[model samples]
Target: MVDELGARFATAGHEIALVGGPVRDILLGRGSKDLDFATSARPEVVERLLAGWANHVWDIGKAFGTIGCRKGEWVLEITTYRSESYDPTSRKPEVSYGDSLEGDLSRRDFAMNAMAVLLPSHQFVDPYGGMEDVANRVIRTPGSPEDSFSDDPLRMMRAARFAAQLDFTPDPAVVAAMEAMADRITIVSAERVRDELIKLVISPQPRKGLDLLVATGLADHVLPELPALQLELDEHHRHKDVYEHSLTVLEQAIDLEPRLGVELPDFVTRFAALIHDIGKPKTRKFEDGGKVTFHHHDVVGAKLAKKRMKALRFSNEQIDQVGKLVELHLRFHGYGTGEWTDSAVRRYVRDAGDLLSRLHVLTRADSTTRNKRKAEALRSAYDDLEERIARLQEQEELDSIRPDLDGNQIME
Candidate 1:
């Protein structure tokens, strides 16, 4: 498809190149379904050029000098070479068409993403040593990190996202810039920050990237609760590091998705695990014997998760799902020796509603216990709960648990 597009562009007297992440991905020996290109053609001409050739085209990105279209199974975006400027207070950039591909690439977020592949001739362009940065597995700005991030602070999150997605470390200069300019992230739209965070969370080994964010002080701007956990004390010191424990929970929750069920987005269980104990920081109390108590942290954490997610522009449905998981995460700990009555199991299942499987994963993941005997006992108890819930589900639709009789029957 790209080859055909390249041929068409060449015939039309427009020089084009595969630009940005796709070109970088190719250099890394990775194939991607999404392709992006830089072309000398204006948006109007590009739209006109693709008018009949493309299977379908959309002008959603027209204002940004982008033309997005899809043909068969191939999805592609072609943007007129752009040079964009931004105001300190505004999240949106002022876009202007650029005449040179090198100038366009230099304005991109990272050096690796600044490389391009000239079409037809297939010549690689690396005006800023992007290929070398790729070879060293490090992220650096084509220009100064300050300039790159100031152009768009959301690029800071992208830096972390790429680190997570590619397992590459940021250059020391970039890290210093990130730490110094962390507050600049506030100027970015919440939606953009949320999107990059979601990418980081869903990336393989997100912890690596998250750790970098925390270390570089970026998490303090986007996810204050995450960094706040590091300062709080856990009771009994069961988990000396709340931040690491939360990450472990996220990992475990991901692993248990198939076991719990995959009907929901994988992010459901993962998000639950990530924020289940977020309340601990707020509820930490010094007990009588130098002991710490996070009484009702689950409930508090649920509220915190909702507030934080809302601030980050999460949807109502996702907010509800994650908030409920945080709230109910501690309920299973109350079950001693599988002693909960059938009524309790019914309430548990009913309260969880469609999130029962999610609750199961969150509860299990919360147990980062070291004592083998205690861990085994907790597992056995949870297993028993599952068995009882299954039995009750067989006898009475536990999911829709209600009074034994309907209103009509009661009236009769």
Candidate 2:
């Protein structure tokens, strides 16, 4: 595909290069179906060239110098070499076509993504030392960190997302710039920030990216609840750190996904685990003997999670799923040593409904206690619960259970 497209463009006296993420992924030996290219040809010319060659073509981003097409199994986005600048208060960027691939690459978010492969000729271009940065496993902007982020403050979040996606560390200067300019993220639309956050949360190494966000104060604007997990230290009480425990739970939930039949990159489960205890800080109370308790934190957390997700413009389905998970994450604790009767088990299954499988994983992952005896006890109790649920499922068809009559039936 690359050779054919490049040959066609070259023959037409236009320049084309496989640019940005596709180029970066190629160097890292990662396979990607999405191909991004930069061309010296204008959008119209690019569209003209792609005619009939592409199985399908679209111009949703034509104004931004981007034309998308698909050929065979490859999804391609061919964009004219462009430079974009954002107004201080606007969420959108004003894009202008550039004349050179180097100039286009220079404006990218990271040096690692700034490399390109000049198509047809197959020449590798690394004017910004992107190859070295990729080899070193570090992230740096093509230009100054400040300039790169100012062009599109969402790039700040992208830095974190890439860190999570690639398992690469940002350079100190990048981190410092993020810390200095964290407030700039507020100007970017909530939808963009939320999308970046979802990518980070679903990545293989979410904790690394999340930690950077918290460390750099980016979370302060985008997700205040995450940093607020660091509740005021009560030296005397000395309970497990809620913030650290949440991260551990997220990792454990991800680890349990395959075993429990939840799909990989289950953002609902992962996000629920991360925010399940967000209400702890809000509900913290000291008893007479200095024992700390977060009474009704599950219920409180459910509301908080829904509210925050709503603000981020998440879909109604996503909001409801995560909210319900947060609310039920603590329900298993009541079944001490499998003491629940058949009725109790039925209610448990009924309450969980479609979320039962995920609930199982979330409840199991929530047991992050270091105490071997307690952890074993929780696991055994859950094992018993699952076994009972399975038996009941066989005997009673608990999965399809419902009220005998609906509201309309009752009315009739």
Candidate 3:
């Protein structure tokens, strides 16, 4: 579908380039199949040109000058050069068409993405020194940082995501702009915020991206729970601030296995790590000797996670998975002791069910601490518990511990 559309656009005498991440990734020697095209042709003309070659065409964002073409398993997006201005109260843009590719590139969110390549000839066009920015490992917005983020607050999240994904530092001015306009993020849709966050958390340097979010004050607007988790206790008896600990867990989770062949994307696990300890603030208590503990924080955190997921308009399945992971995140660490009873393992397996492995990953991440011995001990215990669960399953004890009673089965 990409080839067909590319050919059609090329033949139409319109300058089209397979642009954005696809070209950027190719230059960076990374794999990317998502194709995007930038052209001087108007959106309507591009639509008409693609209609002949593409059997499946949809104007998914025609107002923003985007049209999608699909042929079999491949899909390509063709967009015209355009510029936009945003209302102060909404992320939705008021658009204006641009005569030159430079105008369009100038309006893009990041310098790396602002670069383009000409189709057929494969010549690169970089007006904003995006290639240089990519080479320098820096993320900079096209034109002014304030104008870029003010036009779309979601760009702040995108900055963090690109930083995480590309292992680049955002320009200091851009970071300051993000901090100043953090409250403007509320104008963006929850779904867009969630999408960017998912990408950020899934990236290799997820903790870096999250730290940036907190540092820039963006989390206070989009994820209030995170900043609230930063509340301090009176003494050393308290654990680390929940917000800092959450980032630590996220880093540790990625460091532990680094790879899980689960069907869900890496971002989901990252998101779970970010919110796993959310209940701690609400559950905090001061005992004798200034000892601070969060009793039943997992249970409370699960409920808070669900609310956060809902606020972000996450899918029902995603919300449930994140919530479940938050609720049982602590179960694996203590499983090697008396908690390793056959019945306990069965219940653990049953509670976690399809998410058992992911929960283990989360638990491993959650055990982050300064004490090397404790960390090693937790890892050892978790290993033993996993082996014990396997042995129990082999004995068929797990299979027989169904929740369905004999009377209920007979009634059915």
Candidate 4:
């Protein structure tokens, strides 16, 4: 696809380069389906260039010098060299054409992403040591970190996001710049912030990105609920660090996502795991027995999750799913001895709704105890609960809820 575009543009005396993320990913031996280009040809010219080959073309991004088009089995976006400037009070940037590729590259968020490949010529463009940075596995801005961040503070979060996605560390200078410029993220808008955070959360190494967010003080601005989990001790001084536990649960939930089915996104399980204990910090109370209790944390956490997710521009569906998982997270604790009756199992299934299987994953992953014996016991109990539910389903299908197995049979 790129070869075809490059050949046509080259014949017209315009230099077209496959640019940005696609180029960077290719250098790392990762294939990309979505391709972008920086061409000397203007948007109108690019539109004409694509019209011959494109099955469909759209000019939605034409004002920003981008022309999106699709050819057989390929989606491509070609843009003229861009010199875009952001408005400080508003996150929207005013994008204009730049005469040179260097200007466009310099405006990009990170050096790794700033690299490009001159199509057809197969030439590599690394104006800011992007190749070296990729080799070192460190993220750095193409220009001064401060200047780069001041232009678009969202780059600060992107820096952290890429650090997680690529398992690379941000430069100390970039981290410091993020710390100094954290306030600018507020101007970028909630929806944009939510989008970046979603990318970070969905990355393979989300903990790395989350850690950077906390260390750089970026989480304080974007998601204060996260860092607020730290140092929240119970009355008896008996509690795992909620912050670390939450990260552990995030990892555990991700590991358990296969149970939810391979096709499902792990976002809800991950988000639910990350924020499941959020209410602990809010509901801490000292009891007369010299103990602390978060009596209604699950309930409180559901509300908090709803409020925060809404504030961050998450969809109502997403909020409801996460909040439901949070609210019902502790219900399994009441099912002692795996003695739940058939009616109880049916109620459990009814309460779980479409999230029944997911609730199982969340329930099991929520157990972060180091005691192998207790862990085994909890696993055994959950296995029985699942078996009971399955039995109920089969029986209901076989004889309208009056077939072969009972709670006692399941426990056995």
Query: How displaced is residue 297 in candidate 1, in Å?
Result: 0.9
In the range 84-180, model 3's lDDT, one tens digit per residue, is: 7768778887887777777777888888888887766667788888888888889898788998888888999999888888788999999999999
- Per residue, candidate 1 scores C-alpha lDDT tens digits across 1-412 of 6777888888999978999888889889988767999999999989988887899998858888989998888888999998887887775888989988988998898989999888888888999888998899999999899888887889899999999889899999999999999999998889999999988887777888899889989998899999888854445554367887898888888777778756634776787798788999889877676677788998999999999999999999999999999999999888986578789999999999999988988898777587899888888888889988899888876546666797899899
lDDT of 4 by residue, 1-412 (tens): 7787889999998989988999888878888878888999998899888888889999857888888988888888888998888776776889888888888898899999999888788888899988888889999998899988888888988988898788988989999999998988888889888999998998899999999999989999888889989955655668668899899888888888888974755787889989998898899877787677787999999999999999999999989989999999998988876577778879889988988877888899987588999988888888888888888888878786564789899778
Worst 10 residues of 1 by lDDT: 231-240
TM-score of 2: 0.94
Model 1, runs deviating above 4 Å: 232-239, 263-265, 397-412
C-alpha RMSD of candidate 3: 4.6
Q: On a 0 to 1 TM-score scale, where does candidate 4 land against the true structure?
A: 0.94
Ranking by lDDT: 2, 4, 1, 3
Instruction: Please list the C-alpha lDDT of all candidates, in the order they appear.
Output: 0.87, 0.90, 0.82, 0.87
- The C-alpha TM-scores of every prediction are 0.92, 0.94, 0.87, 0.94
**Which model scores highest in TM-score?**
2
Provide the lDDT at 341 for model 1: 79
Off by over 4 Å in 2: 260-262, 398-412
- RMSD per prediction, one decimal? 3.8, 4.6, 4.6, 4.6
Q: Which stretches in model 3 have alpha-carbon errors above 4 Å? A: 1-11, 51-58, 70-74, 231-238, 256-260, 332-340, 397-412
Q: Relative to the unseen true structure, what is the C-alpha lDDT of residue 391 in candidate 4, on a scale of 0 to 100?
A: 83
